[model samples]
Target: MTIEKTETINITSPLDIETVEKLHAGDRVLLSGVIYVARDAAHKRLVHALDQGEELPFDPKGQTLYYMGPSPAPPGRKIGSVGPTTSTRMDSYTPRLLAAGVRAMIGKGSRSAEVRESIKEYKAVYFVATGGAGALLHRTIKNVEPVAYEDLGAEAVLRLLVEDFPLIVANDIYGGDVFEQGRAEYRRGGN
Candidate 1:
C-alpha cells in the first residue's frame, strides 16, 4: 500500500504531550531513547494494581509501552529478537492505562474503537513496528534491564535503551488512523 508522502521523523520515548500531539498517522519515525516492554500478563498486573489503588511498578506518565515478549538473548547480545505482538490483545486495558498517563504505545495491528477513542481523549499516540523484523529491530536495542514482574520472565516489564528504532505512526491524537485511511484508499482505488 502506498502512504502519501510519508515523512521521516526522529523522536524519543517517555514522550511528553507536546511531542505526541505533533505526530500524524502515516508518518515514519525513528524512535530513540527509553521504552518499557510488557505483554498481556504484565498488562493485567498493571491494571490490577491500578484497580487496587496501588502504585504502578513504573510511572506511566510520558511513557511508551511496547507490546512484546522477547526471546532469550544470544551470547554477546544485549537482547533477543524483539518484535511487536498484535495490539488488539491489550485493547481491554488500554483506556485505563491511557488515563493513567501513558503517552504512546508500540505494537502491530489495529486497535479497538475504545483504544482509539482513548488515544484521542488522552492525547496519546499508537505506533506500529515492522512485524517480522525482530532481528533488525533487536540491533537497535543498546541495553536491557529487568524492570518488574521478573517471575514472568520474557513477559516481564523491561527497560530498553534503543537508538533509531523504526516505526510508523498508526494513530494520532487528532484521531488520524493509518489503518482505516489505508483501507479507504484501497477501496477507492478499486483494489
Candidate 2:
C-alpha cells in the first residue's frame, strides 16, 4: 500500500462547520484557540442540566470539548499536567453534546458506534491527543479559568486558551476512523 503524506493543519477553536467538514480522520492538526475542558463527571452534570431545562454553563454551539482533568498548577504556571482522559467514559453523554452543536471533541481512544454515528449526524469530529504527553500538552495551554461545577475540583469545566495544541483526527464527520485504518494497515502488513 502506498503511504500518503499527512498535512498538518493549524486550527482555531470554536471550530466552524466548514473547518470541521474539511478535516478527515488521520489528519494531524495543531489547534490554537479556545476549548473547554470536561470529563465524565462534568458531562453528566451538563446533560442533567439540559434534561431539567437549565441553561448550560457554556453554549455548546461551535464549541470544542477536551476530555481532561488537570492537576493543580504549580507556582506561576497556567496549568499542570493537562492530559486527555479516556474518552469512552464520556460516550453516553457525547451524542447529547453533539446534538447541542458541539463541533469537535479532543481525547484519546475509540468511540462507541452510537457516538460515531452521532458525530456524523451532527457534522462533528473527534480528535486524539498523544496519551502520555500531558507535560508537553500543558505547554500549549496559555490560559485556564474554571468555568463551572467548581465543586468537582479537577473535574470542573474550564475554559482554556491553547496555542498549537497537537492532535490527530481519530474520527471525522465523513465516517472515517483512523484507528480502524491503522489496524487494517497493520493486519495487511502495510505498516
Candidate 3:
C-alpha cells in the first residue's frame, strides 16, 4: 500500500516513538522539506567545520541525511544505481549530527550501539532500504539535483526528490529496531 502525506512533516525533535513506529518497511514515503546530505568524507569535514566554528552547509534541525553514494549517472537519467551503503562507517559522525538536530537517517543495514543510543537521546529514526535493490530503489526516486559538496565528485552531497521512496524501519525513537525484530521473529522457526 502506498503511504502518503501531503503536508510537509515539520519535525521538531525530540521526536516521539509512536510517530516513528507508524513507519514500516515497504512504506511509500514522500519526504519533502529540507535535509542534509552527508557521506563518509563529507561527514569528517562537517565535524571539523564545527570545530572551526564555521556555519554548517545545511541546517541539521528538522532534517534527514541519506547515506548513499550514487554511481555517476548516464545522461538523461536522474540518478544511476542510487542505493544505500554501509551505515557503520558513519557511526562516528552520527551522534554529533543527531546532537545537531538530525531527526532521521536513510540507509541500509544496522548501526553501532553508539548510533542507536544517540537515536534514543536525540529522538531520531533510522530508515533502512533493502540491500541489492538499486534498480528497484531508483524507480522510487522521481527527481535528483545536486546540493553542495560537489567537489567531492559522486561522493558529492545531493538533494534528491523522491516519490514514494520505499523503505524499512530499522531503528526508531522508541529503540524499536527491525534488524533485531526479524532475528527474534525468525529465530523461533517461523520460516
Cα lDDT listed for each candidate:
0.92, 0.92, 0.72
In candidate 1, which residue pairs clash? Answer: none
| lDDT tens per residue, model 1, 1-191 | 13233557889988988888789999898899999999999999999999999999999998999999999998988889999999999999999999999989999999999999999999999999999889889888999989999999989999999988889999998889999999887775535
Candidate 3 per-residue lDDT, tens place, 143-184, comes to 777767889986787776665565666786667778777887
Candidate 1 displacement at residue 20 in angstroms: 1.2
lDDT of 1: 0.92
RMSD of 3: 4.4
List residue ranges in candidate 2 displaced over 4 A. Answer: 1-6, 188-191
In the range 1-191, model 2's lDDT, one tens digit per residue, is 01222558888999998999999999988899999999989999999998998889999899999999999999999889987989999999999889888889999999999999999999999999988888888888999888999999999999999988888999998899999999887785544
| TM-scores for every candidate against the unseen true structure | 0.94, 0.94, 0.81
Residue pairs clashing, model 3: none
TM-score winner, 2 or 3: 2
